[model samples]
Target: MSAPAPHGPAFSGRVGWGSRPAVLVVDLCRAYTEPDGPFALPDPGPAVEATSALVEAARASGRPVVWTAVRYAAGLADGGLFVRKVPALAAFAEDAPGDWGALTLEPGPGEPVVVKQYASAFSGTSLAATLHAAGVDTVVVAGVSTSGCVRATATDALTAGFRPQVVRQACADRSATLHDTNLADLDAKYADVVDLPEALAHL
Candidate 1:
């Protein structure tokens, strides 16, 4: 079920390079993007491609391009609700082949990588301070599990006083229904939702 768009304040968009926006790519790791393989969530290929574009744009514009990965130590003991949500996630060992396997994007030069244990990147992490330090008042997010991590982060971003701009086509969940529905819900309430081209135009 695709979420229905809400009728509210029309957002023309207040985020762009002019405002020192940062692009946060969340969980594009193998644990969620592989096709129909283990730990896979829907098709994240398009999201990856779109995210890559955003990364390049952010880099070109001299803004922060941050990436986040969800990882536990090496055992379930380090994982709490994460262990309960999908016990299989514990398999993301140091470099062992688990779900979609390990994430590939290594932080290059200035890119800040945040490792988190929960759905919301803002939870128990220095993400807020980092964004503040970087003078980023708006966030452009793209990543996995639209209904979970993406939604949680967007909500947190809003509450934290940063404008959250979500790329509708740059995030995915395990189900098309879930991805679209969550996008609709986030669009109606929490974040600014727009397709890639429109987002780029506004930016």
Candidate 2:
């Protein structure tokens, strides 16, 4: 038997990296990175290392870097239905012990950190305006849970009129299947999924 056809011809259009790009690190928090944490992935090291390289390359190129974290008020008053749906999010509550929501890759001076309650980094946040103010025409997306926050943020970035480039090696998920599936979807419809070297070159 032959394999199925790819998602091209219909969703083949590519929005290549623009002239001005900013690395958007989404939800690379301790909750997902720490092995003992509730939301830890099977293997977070590769994604973390790739994302760190992307961040470093962006900074060295003098490009802007934005970080996003999921934080909710005590009792999840700010998380809305998302918290109720995924109780694991309690790890990010303001009063949660050990600051589990803290970013694994700390933001540097002058770097903007956007705290959100939902999956998408651009949802209910100043991320669009921040990117606009920085003259960023493209978003180099990285971070945890490729099937969740990373996919959402990449879609929203495209919706907000910015080119979205999802670094394939810089995003992780609970499983390899989940990560690969979502990256394929994002590349077909919303973002251009590229490798770390390609992303670094763009930066």
The model with the greatest TM-score is 2
Clashing pairs in 1: 3-181
TM-score of 2: 0.96
> How many clashes does the backbone of model 2 have?
0
Could you give candidate 1's per-residue lDDT for residues 1-203 as a string of tens digits?
Answer: 96643454563334332366888988778767655455676567788888887777777778788888876765555678776877666665444455454564555697878988888999999999999988988898888879988899998998898889999888888889888888887877788887788656544
Give the Cα lDDT of each candidate: 0.77, 0.92
Model 1, global lDDT: 0.77
Q: Which candidate is the best by lDDT?
A: 2
Q: Can you give the lDDT of residue 2 in candidate 1?
A: 66
TM-score of each: 0.85, 0.96
Residue-level lDDT for 45 in candidate 2 = 96
TM-score of 1: 0.85
Residue-level lDDT of model 2, residues 4-99, one tens digit each, is: 559746885799978999999999988889998889888999999999999999999999999998888898888889988998998898888988
